[model samples]
Target chain A: MEHHQSKSFPISHVIGFVVSLVLTFGAAGIALKTNLSFKVIMWIIGSLAVIQAGMQLFMFMHLREGEDGKTNLVNMIYAVFMVIVIVVGSIWVLTSGHAAH
Target chain B: MGIKWDEFFITGDPLILGSQIAILLTMIGAVAAITYLKKWKYLWTEWLTTVDHKKIGIMYIISAVLMFFRGGMDGLLMKAQTARPEMEFLNSQHYNEIFTTHGVIMILFMAMPFLIGLMNVVIPLQIGARDVAFPQLNALSFWLFFSGAMLFNISFVIGGSPDAGWTSYFPLAGKEFSPGIGNNFYAVALQIAGIGTLMTGINFIVTILKMRTKGMTLMKMPMFTWTTFVTSILIVAAFPIFTVALALMTFDRLYGTHFFTVSGGGMDMLWANLFWLWGHPEVYIVALPAFGIFSEVIATFSRKSLFGYKSMVFSILGIALLSMVVWVHHFYTMGSGPAVNSFFSITTMAIAIPTGVKMFNWLFTMRKGRIKITSAMLWALAFVPCFVIGGVTGVMLAMGAADYQYHNTLFLVAHFHYVLIPGVVFAVFAGLYYWWPKMFGFMLNEKIGKWHFWLFVIGFNVTFMPMFFLGLNGAVRRAYTYSAESGFAPLFMLSAIGSIILAAGFAVFCYNIYWSIRYADRNISSDPWDARTLEWSTASPVQFYNFAKLPEVKSLDPFWHMKKKNEGLTLFDSEIEEIHMPSNSWLPIYMGVIFGIAGFLLVFEWHIAAAVAAIGIFAGLIIRSFDYNEGFHVKKDEIHRIENAWRKTEGEVHDHVS
Candidate 1:
């Protein structure tokens, strides 16, 4: 764990890059070659997107590195929750219910 | 070159013409006085280019006070206009402009910068940091805000003031409706200031996070520091939305884009959503700091450590988070239906719980403790009950079904004033009085401060309480006058009288400052209040380098603990060292001027000239980016001398008191 904390080489970066590549190509291949329904394709791609974001947050940003790591992680999760509530909630309410349309 | 000379000159109204003349004369007089005194260089070196957070904070306070005067005058004129039925004190357009400027200047210029000023001055000292993380950037923030304010202020005498409203909502704010450069000033000025505020947010966050004294954990930080941290987060998250919203509005108004136009694929509600998305959090950006200030004042005066310190921190964070989600409640009647309104209603009401927790914490802190009735504590005490009234009415308005009846009425007006005046305004006064000795070297006159407090509180209640009744009796806002038969005459008259009284209260407060500065004793000790915070551990009118030796924090209220244990209270045992301070530069002022020029030119549709000025701004930025003048340092001998003098004075003060 102590050795891993030192970024004197590119091993972690390479691993993160390779994993991101596989996820991206896997989703693209499913969309292009597979005859899955549109909803199913969207689900797969969306899950892939979430995984990519997590990778970026953990591997690149080092969300859990210092004393503030836990606070940072919690705040990020809370921020995501708020964004979802705002964007998804706005779209849901605006497109349905007693909206003007 | 699309300027219309007639509209640009802003002629026709005698009242406006008189005011324009008065403003011009004032400007000339100020310049002449400065020139006669040969103080231009002194002003430039000491103030305009200084990177000291304390000096910058003083500049912010002065500018914000001037703006408060301007906004207050606007308020008085509006009240006079509506004092009686068919009053002709101001015409419809003039009334519209006054109220619009009043709202914009009061909130953005007066309240926002006033609080930010206090934060800049106090936060660094509280956390035992030498200065903010980026001292030069802090100076840049102040200059930008000042330039924006100056540009917006000139709108009254030149061109015209924005008449659509402070919100500058769609269609009405579009070019077809407001063809002049008024709304353009609103967009460009706010954009400039908003950018400044955003930099300040980022600056303080980095400072508080990375610059704390040793052993001062997040949980061990002062309440003001905690509040500043959370407020900074809110600023970072919320200001960008405003930046985008204002930019879109600018494009729509100037370039004829349809982002919020009624026709051509434009959606009006998008502006509302984006505006409030930022606007709601902007309230807490001003408010949470007030909460922090109250916590400090309450604990100091009550002679107790803050009760439920962890809970207070959580409540502040909770309010910050909740502030974002509750923006939709502002426009619940915008026809998003029960599903949307109910969701927002619940979230809006949920905010009250955290806020209530904070109120109770303050109460419990004061309980069974020695409570000093200082002016600062008086303001804090007044804030509790007044803010509760505002909060309760807020919950009432949060009910989706009931809001239809209360929306856009004087009741809405009353509710917000209750929140803002008591919450933000009272807190600023409390902070000013509490931190007066630190900022200056002397205390404010307590007797005069009491006069300022009582008059302002009574005047505030008198001004706003009647609006609730009048609003219930079918009185609407933004109306210049109502018919005599509408039966709002008595209440309107009463409210206008209350405004005059409020103006008097403000006048007394200003006078108190003048009197105190002239006569207040300067030989007072550093710790006048026997306060528990770290800031109080320093000398009054703190040195250029805040602390000669950085304190080692062992617990919460570190100073109090040091005093109680009679250990390490003074740094006489520690060796003095050279202190590095950021060098002052003229780049920020240059950038501010160019930005202001660009903004003014854009308001007149001089795109080419504006573009050139914009390039100059970027050039200033580029110079700043490459500049290698890191700073200068106070020599060890100089530090030793300053520290010796401070100790001598401390000894004298202790002798005189004992």
Candidate 2:
């Protein structure tokens, strides 16, 4: 089992780090230098953040690399869904037309 | 020092003063007894610093039982105070503190540890693993939790208790309104304990995923193990939310941050939302394991395999997922509107489906099998009907519109107690009864256990059932008293009497332990219940190295299969070699003390002292990181010596029985 991969340099990790950096700085550049509307910039940054997170998980963390990898992947996806439900749901409810404020 | 000596010591309340004295005397007595026995070195080496999961689990169980006693006392105090109209047993302020402590201690200290203790004791053994993946980390988790519980417990006598609700909603918990160190204890203590729980979560997840015996697939694991796996995932995901919430609340209280304040652009509602966000899943974290326990117990006692094993596992996963999305149901009255409420209502009601699936699975598991009416099975049996009442009421409350009527009323109180008491508490009792013979070597007295069970169940229903009617009659909760003319006095008195019965039931359980230890039958075999699962393959009062040679798992109930086929009973058939085991260390207890000192100082706003203690803790961590001791191994001779001694005891028992 150990002989299948001597695991020299982690080229995938290097690529992931570089890609993450590019996406992060790209979003920052758009926020600072571009004349795009706030909404458009927000969308771009959100997409970059999601993509960067995915890279970190799959490439860096090796979340899908073992017998239990599928369970791990499914749990991560469900966790993401829960985060969205909590964060977005809270914001929506608290900022809605019928909020206590 | 920011502390005022006069206010800090909590004087002028006779009830509290009496309790303070009692607590002091008890501590002194305990210390004196331990010293008189001259067991300090033995205790320190064998128990305190031990990293064995079984011993750690026993310690957790002992501590949880003690906390349950403390919390139950707080509850009886509430009952006495509210037994009748115009009761003067407890003033409003004292009532507030008692209720707060009661809620916090019962949920966090008692219920959580009880379940975690059982999991620690059973999960590794159930999976045919020697121990959890990280045994030292497991010990640290227990110590951290113990220290946290201690820190919280000391608040009542030292500086008063948190008078805000256990939920500790801000503006109420803020420094302006609270102006004391009570809520500070809540934030810091739970923060410490929650971190420990999160570590246990990660530890178990890794253990189950990476260290199962050969041929045991995930789907082939027992129902209890499956629930443990899912519950651990829930803990890992949910506890971080609580960690962040507690940190922000601590900042708001200690450092004058506006995170949950009504002013400074802060939204107090965020606290509530974040709280329930973690809080809802936390309910499942406790209940799901209880569900797993019932599944295992029901199948074993019924003399059948667990029904719908695949669906049982999937329903657990389903419940775990649904648990995260239903937080909003807790606050439908917060004016989140029909859209938000409807969404939450649907999700909340949807939980019943998975729960119903579980309920049906248990029923079918026992449908046509030989049902043994043992004390453990009785608790599981009672749980079905009681939990159904709780669950149906839960679905009723899930209606956002209907909850508006039930909100903040005793109806709501009755509803949750229905759910939690039967759902979590009864299951704890069931697991305790079922696993007691495994943890200890003797069975608990059956007649006494039946008495305890019946009184507890009847008293529980008698106490909480009237609250539903009271809620419908517009009686509110958290009130210190009601007028005689309110027509709630009779029911309140009845509930108070029922609580006394419940207390009697708990007393009987304590007596049962004492009685059993002294006089019960002791020649019982390891598998006293003739049950399934790999845990029973080991000796009762399980060996430290669990299995002398690791057993091969071929199915969910490997022990049952082995027993039926007369295979794998003598696990030491393989050549006995040196077995590697983790060494015990004092580092965990030292870290616990360091964290405790830091927390106590911070509670009093002693920044310099706290910083020094915090630095000491970090230094301990750094020292641990550099340490390279990989632990010791038990030689083959030592293994043979222990095995022979065990065999001698077994042979004696066999001769006595024959």
Candidate 3:
């Protein structure tokens, strides 16, 4: 499977590497430097992390390069769905108990 | 929580002391027997180091059975103590520990492994793969799980057993209340095992998705394989929450963090929420496969195609998605209020739709068909009503307001036991009976199996049926004893008697294992049950390289279809290819031991030792990266020899090949 490794200039790896680093620092800066409310700050950082992870999957991890790439994408999407359920549900259950309902 | 050297090795309980001695003797005896028989190298090479999924699966089954008996013993003790009012058998603390350990071991250590063992043994073959996606990782998963289980089991003899309920909700599990190192076992041991389970999830997803034979599309996969795929997805999604929860718990207990502690702005309810978030889907992780097992068993025995096979697939998928939302039903009375409660309650009740669909599918499967009543089929058949009782009661408890009455009551206890016993335990037995000959070389004795089944199923009902009443009669759970005036005695006594019968049934099961090994007919067909999946296409006591030439898959129940068409596994003129098999590695076991030591040290707050052991664990990973163990290949001549031997004994399968 790894036989396709080439001696070509790997621009994708470099781009993914720089983007991941920037996202990491960018999220940290938002959490530490911003005067935003806790909930807002958390949302910003979580979104950044998800974006960074998606980039890593496509660019660095080659998640979309294989024959099973579509399946991998679906698995990740399901994982993201579960994460949203857990995070959103926990917040709803904990703080206001979702009085809007 | 401070560690006390003198408090180590619990001395007061006579039962514990006896067990401590028994454990020592058993360990010594095993070592001595291995040494005397001069089989240490053989053991190390063949059993411990081998990456064969079948062998690893057998090892899992053995550990799960031992733990099952241990958990069963704890259950029996709890029953004996509660059998009558004011019983003096177990003090409150001892009773607390017994019940807690019983819940943890039965759910985590027992049921999970039993199903996983079957999955490991059967999934690859059913999916038509040589091994899992990663064979060495599979080995690692098993050892880590086994080691973690051992670490948890040792807690009773060592510092103390975790006295909190198996749920291990915080404040109770927090260091202030649980001042000993007991719940540390809950945190660390389960974390270790949870990682193993997570890896197993990933391994299976890749295997089922990527490793299926030609012509077997996703829809064409057998029901069991499909269930396994769904279960793996649930495991991956759910267990991370447990791992995170346990990590936080470890931090709170050991480093004195306040993630779950009462003070320092900690939220205790978060632990409960997180636990059930993982815990609810965790049940389906075990249950869906049982559904798959029953699908295979029922269809095979009834001589029919599974009724609503597509619906079975989609319902399990629906159940998995719904499971995530309904965890809050576990704590509806925690005052999440009407909106949250109703939402969760509705989702909880909604689960019954799919579950009911499955329940009827099984019945419709047997409807107007040639139903053969094997011992395995009997278990599958019996599961319907028992699970229905469990599921219906579960729906009752799902009503948020109604749960206020049921919470912490034996009614809740009765409800789950009804569900899990039939849903998980009965399936284990059915799968065991159905697949025994394929694993070993002979069938389990049916007459003795009948005794085991009748006694166990009856005992199961007799023990738990009264609990629903006792619970409704205002009996709280985890109460060591009650006064005669409370009038909970007669029913408790009846339950106790039922437990005794259960124990006897289990004893008969153990005896059946021995009897079958010694005297059951060995000259059985490879397809002992005339079964439908690809697993039966190979020889009984299947070869190290499972299929000599990989079997072609034309449709669902490929082997059965092959039989109908008067076909063999592969073309007789087809050239047998040399097979690639993973090499044996001691690294997995070594990693387990290292992690076990680290976890043990961390449990007692011996930081330096744990850190050193942690380094050893890391060293294993480092070594693995550099190690180029590309594995070995089975030559064509060897494959031919093995194939000929199977055909010689069971010429029926290959008779039509030429």
Candidate 4:
């Protein structure tokens, strides 16, 4: 009788998940432990969260599997860029001249 | 925490007392009428609990029409108060309430519902789908919207309408400044409506993305469907920001938390940012559908395919994308500095390019084809010039320096009314005329329709055009009454007269609708306009399941192309399988009622009871969801029986005509 082989999970996905977890924990740990800049910790955490979201989207949501995957990805990126520009730019411009010391 | 019945009584005023009585009476009357007409069961089964998109859409339109009358009455009140100098007909506070309610109702209750209703009715049909994805959610969304509208109107009687502008700018709207139930009503009403809008957005996105028929690619989708998709996206991304803003405002009002209170370590500007973030996209959410309506009307009447279809689609998406960045343009007077202002100004100006592309697309659509200037087509044509002027002025106002002069002036009012009235409202009217035949198996009276169109267009321009001059001449907006010595009285009088004309036009339209429904030909042909979409391929007054047999699309103008090639042939197979549809449920309406009651209680500070009720209602919804009842389907033989009857009638008519 022939033995049927079960499919294995991709090594890259495991690596990506592990890295995301480490980064998340590291950022939290740094914020908790250090008198050094907390803002830097927040930025690192935020970036890590964004990356994790992307990884999950691609690896889990199967965003890149369909015929329209490239188009959908591009549209999402554009939307994200627009969002960042609006939110960040609004804050920067509103505060640039009027920030109290 | 217990129910604060004593505190609720303390907040009461006589004005509120009076209005409450009036609202109660109206509700009683409505209930009595429903009972008298023997429509209780029918309303419950067909309208309130219906998961059918077309039925839900019709209900939405009915709700919006009712709200339009309420909002229009508010507008007339404002006009009446402002008509004469030092007019003591209404107090300043009353006038403020009137205008605020008008703005709120017109945008939220009237325009949004109307557009959404049109989309719900038409998008699935156009895309060759049986119904929208998540039909039950669609019903819930409509109920949510209805509940919000009900809450908003109820504010007039219960306490007072929101006195702050529809924008509800803070400092004025904050708890310290606005210590009343009015602002609470605004917050809760919008919160409820905003949820509905958000759900609708998600529903449409899912439907458009996942439920299009085979061969109906994105590029090949109708312009209206494209607009629906983009508008849904706008709703998903933008409405959440509004929800957050409203939630914060609610917290500030109810819990003494400081989100927008300036002295309480909160920023008023944050409210402005959040509101405008949603506000700007909201303009496109309304306008894009209007654009789509024009595209369809122009193409069908002109006997041509929509010119620059790809560009038009891209332009809609572009506009949706750009709308978010340009919110700051609304507040150039806030001292955002030249750099910030310039960035917003340039972005706002950039939007004009895509809008311009759309304009040219419409004009070219009418350039060389056999144009039939029906009432709907006339509205589309009138929209061209009216919306162009509005769009141009929009760009003008986008210039930071120019906006300084225009901001908070009647000019800004004129510009928006120009766009909203002729652009959004007229497009809605045109769509109603165009699709009435399909929805109701009868044509509206062309003679009466023409009267409505011409009178409306002329009166609209007359009413709003002078406001531009008034703004330029230094007249401010939101004033309850102006003095004769202020040199603004003549223009104000002119505007008031123009408003009367516009009201007259609306009256004519109402009359036409009434008359046409009573006396017009009952047997309207299925493809009355010989249009392109899948909707025209179905029976007039589309059956409950919509398509008896699913249509096979061969090209962009599937119905039109098929008719030309195969001599009015359909590829729908006679052998139809059992079609599964969603069953009607009372949960959505019940949920809406619970929310409405909770809102009323919260607005009056009856928090504990309201919270209990809310939890109970949600629990009921969850329990109801577990009770799955499979919907019945029309079998193949039943479909054939219905189709053969329709065919025989059609054949008899054709023979008589020939």
Candidate 5:
């Protein structure tokens, strides 16, 4: 009889981490230096943050390796979709409605 | 340099002053009664300081029951005031306080704690674990919750409870509007309770993840365990957002900061966003466990495996995820536009799919199986139709366009009460009946239990059903009194009548509990209901150390399979090993008391002293953690003696059979 131990991590995680850092700082720098619209800068930074969060999920949290990894990934994506609908939808509606003005 | 007692002790109105005096006397009387009964020592030894999950679970139930009475009193007050149009039993401010406190205490203190407590007692035992992963943390969490409960109740005597709704929607909760200690109490109490909830969540997650015996894989775990796991994850992820929101609100109130104040560049919508961020998941956090309870009870009483076990688990997860998105739907009337409303509306409706899947699974579970109409089973079966109605109406409300007509009306009230009463409260009742025999040695009286169930179901429907029609007729919520000329008098009277019936149901429930304890014959059989879980493999009143030797898990229904395979073999084998358990300590109580004092002081703005008290509490907790009280184990001979006695009883049974 042998004890079964799952493999903990792999090398692709390192690549993901490096890429996340580069994109995060790159987005921050662009936002800081630009005289462009604040909304555009916000969009860029927000996108970067999302990517970084995703990278962390995959690399550090090992979202893709467990027995239920695929299921978990799908769940995470669905959760993200719901989060966007809530957060974004709330701002859009409240701002545009006659009550706010 | 010194404390300003005069400023802190200001009493605004004579009514508030009178209410405070009455509450104080009641508390004093309760303390005196406890002392007179000579139950002080017993309470301390068995309940106050015990870390046994079952005992802790019992304590949680007791707390919820007590809080329910308090919250219910608040509800009755609101009802009496609202029984007629423009009837002036209570002022507008007083009515606001009553309803707000009722909603907050009932949801946060009564329902949540009761569910969590039931889960704490049953989940580990169901999953074949001796205790939770972190036993000390479990004890601490209960105390924190108790302290929070104390703070919430104390507000009645000190000033008033939070006048803002349980949602604590800002601009109103902001300092410019709410200038008293009520909001402070709300913030601090929730912060404390939220921490306990978070810790309990982590503890359960660890218990489920790390403490499962061999072969009890993720999917093989009980439906109750699955629900606990999902609910715990929701707690951990969402409760922190509440903590942050409360902290920011506190800053605004206490420090003249403008986090939520409109004039100070504080965005009120930020509060909405943050509060709902936590609030939406919170509804599911409460409901998911109930969902799990129904799944277990439905299958067991029906004599079947869950119809779709995997789908049930996935649905639990799905609801947990979708809940976070649907928080915005709550505030659709707050002027978020059609596009935003439509998005939230769709996401909210998406929640119905998972919920529908669960309902079908429960129905399918009952399709062909031999159904036993036990009290627990009755609640579960009733919950199906009741919750489905609630669910359908929920979907109706989720349609953004339709919500304009429904927002803040008695219709919204009817919708939630429909879901909450049948959805959460009934499920809790189901769990209580289903697990009562396992937790206690004797069965709860089935006749009385049935009476409780029926009265509650009928009363609940009567009470909330008419509110739907009232809301449709343009009746608003949170009104102290509506005018007779408002054309809502008949509905109000109907609701009032319904409330009285509901109160009668609760009274019957209390009496039933008393009668069951006194009259029900104590059956000492370990598997009294022929339960499938590992919890039933122990003695009727389970030992402090749950299992003498942990049983080997071979299948989903391990105990059932074991009994079916070899009825002669004992559930426990002769491998007696020393069991390590945590020793009881007074530190948890001590820390709870100190923090309780600190919260009281902070609410009253005893700033410097409050900080000192908080530091002292933290220091005591840290010190207690370092002082080890490693538990001594029972000798092998004691274990042998107990085993032999059981074996002897078994031999007598066998002899009789021969």
Candidate 6:
């Protein structure tokens, strides 16, 4: 694992990049191509976003590159938590029950 | 699209006219004094262009104090206007403007910077770092905040103060309702200041994480540094939401986009949701640091280590996490439905658990300890009961069902003041008193400081406490006056009297500064309080390069251990090398001035001039990218000389004390 990371052009980056692209276009395709409900579409997109973000951080951003790697990863996770709480909570409250049009 | 000269100048009110003259005279006086004293070059080189964190902290503090005075005067004016039945000291519009400016300045301009200022000064030394990770960026942060504050302040005389209140909620603050340039200051000035605060947050986080001395692991670090670290995290996470919110506001007002418009497919409640999303954490941004300062002071004066140190750290982190979810309570009455409100209400009340832990930690730290009752200690002591009152009322407001009765009333007003005055303001006073010697090499008078504390705390309670009863009696906020038959006359009169006493307390505090400069002894020891933190290990009024040789940290209370062992007294056991420091540059103030001009122009809808000024801001970035001045160095000999002088004084003071 250590030797593989020291490569000039790692296989992991290529695999990560390809996976990220597939995830992005796949989510878009499911949204535009499918006849899914809004709730299902949102769920798919949100889960895709989380996967892509995690992949990017570890692969592209080198979140595990330094002595502060654990800290950086923890911070990223906490930030993701805040984003999920705020976005999902706001949408849920605003679009349902008494707040609904 | 333009304002005429007569309408632009704020011509009518005599009170505003008086302040206009005062501003003019103060400017002219400052310029004349700088020139007459032949200190223009010195001031420019030392203060304006340099990237020293200590100097920047002093500048932040000075501005916070001045803004405090301005905000306090606004308070006095509002109180005076409502002192009697149907009083006409200020008409309703002017009253609206004053209260709006009061809230904005007190929170954004005053409390935020005051805490940030303390964090900037103390964090480096406490962790044994030479300076912040990015010194030049720190200087830029100070200038940006300064320029933004100036832009907000000038609205009083030039355009007009924002009258839709500091929260700047939508539909009320939209162009349709507030068509004048007044609300524009809110959109532009806060954007500038908010950006600066976000940068400060990032700077301190990197500093604490990367710059601590060897063996000073995360848990070994001081409480103040821990608080700063957490506060910086809060700032990074929370401030971006505000920046986006303000930009949406700017677009809705300036370019006629409908992000928050009443018509045009806009959702007004989106602004409220976003505002509180950022706004709730903004409370902890100021508050967590105050808790840190109180921890340091309480531990020092109590002659005991902070009780439950690990628990204190966890509780602060817990508060930061909880602060984000609880914001919907700010507008429970907006009818987001029982389910939504219940979710928020439970999260809001959950905050009390961690806060209660912290309160118990402070009290337990003092129990059975040899507590010295100094001015700083008094402030910390007073904060306990006072902040508890605030917290209990907050829990009362947290109940979604009961909030319908308390919304938009003086009860809300009283709740915040109880929290802020004790939690933020009193803590700032305690910190200033505690750290004054570290900043200036002299002590504040204990007698005078006590007088400042007593009058302020008593007057603070007298003013805000009655507002709760009045709020329960159906006194709504933002009402300019009350009828005598309605029976709010006497309580308001009492609150007005309390404000006068509070003003007197502030006056005494200022006078103490002047008096101490003249009379306080300069020969005191570095560790006059015999404190346990690494900050007290350095000489008073710390050196520019904070330590010659960074002390080796072995424990949480490294300095106290070193003192007890009677070893490492010189703190220069290691060899000295040439110290590299960042070079002073003109780019920061240049960007601050030019960006402020852009903000001013944008406020008045001068698109052409504003665009031109906006270009000047980018020009600063261009110049900086090309500039090759990395920094200068303090030679080994210079370090030796400075370190020896400090050690000699330390030896003499220890001898004298013994």
> Which regions of candidate 3 deviate over 4 angstroms?
A1-73, A97-101, B1-3, B570-574, B654-658
True contacts kept of each: 0.41, 0.52, 0.41, 0.21, 0.52, 0.41
Task: Provide DockQ values for all models, in the order shown.
Answer: 0.24, 0.37, 0.39, 0.18, 0.27, 0.27
Judged by whole-model lDDT over C-alpha atoms, candidate 4 comes out at 0.84
Candidate 6 regions off by >4 Å?
A: A1-69, B1-3, B571-574, B650-658
DockQ value for model 1: 0.24
TM-score of each: 0.91, 0.92, 0.95, 0.90, 0.87, 0.93
TM-score of chain B in each prediction: 0.98, 0.98, 0.98, 0.95, 0.95, 0.98
For model 1 chain B, the run of ten residues with the poorest summed lDDT:
B649-658
Sorted on DockQ, best first, the list reads 3, 2, 5, 6, 1, 4
**Residue-by-residue lDDT tens digits, candidate 5, A1-101:** 02434466557878887888799789979877878798989888888888787778777876766788676877687667756755574566557765467
| Evaluation by lDDT, superior candidate among 1 and 6 | 6
Interface RMSD of 4: 6.9
Q: What's the lDDT for residue B327 in model 4?
A: 90
**Number of the top-ranking candidate, with TM-score as the measure:** 3
Superposed Cα RMSD, model 3: 2.8
Model 4 clashing residue pairs (backbone): B19-B157
Worst 10 residues of 4 chain B by lDDT: B649-658
Going through the candidates in order, state the TM-score of chain A alone for each one.
0.69, 0.75, 0.68, 0.53, 0.59, 0.67
The lDDT values for all models are 0.89, 0.88, 0.90, 0.84, 0.81, 0.90
What lDDT tens digits, residue by residue, belong to model 4 across residues A1-101?
A: 02533458577678777877887787777767877776777777778777776777776655766678677877788767866865686577558544322
lDDT of 3 by residue, B5-99 (tens): 89888898889999999999999999999999999999999899989999999999999999999999999999999988999999999999999
Q: In model 1, how large is the Cα lDDT of residue B570?
A: 58
Which CAPRI category fits model 5?
acceptable
Q: How close is candidate 5 to the true structure, as a TM-score?
A: 0.87
Using TM-score as the yardstick, the better of models 2 and 5 is 2
What lDDT tens digits, residue by residue, belong to model 6 across residues B1-658? 4557776889888999999999999999999999999999999999999899999999999999999999999999999999998998999999989999999999999999999899888999999988999898898899999999999999999989999988988899999999988999999999999989999999999999899998899999999999999999999999999999999999999999999996998899899989989999999999999999999999989988899999999999899989988889999988888888898899999999999999999999999989999999999999999999999999999999999999999999999999999999999999999999999988999999999999999899999998999999999998888899989989998999999999999999999999999999998877778788888777788889988878789887887777777655654535788888888888889988998999999988889989999999989999987676768899988888887877777434344222
How do all the candidates rank in terms of TM-score, highest first? 3, 6, 2, 1, 4, 5
Error of 6 at B42 (Å): 0.9
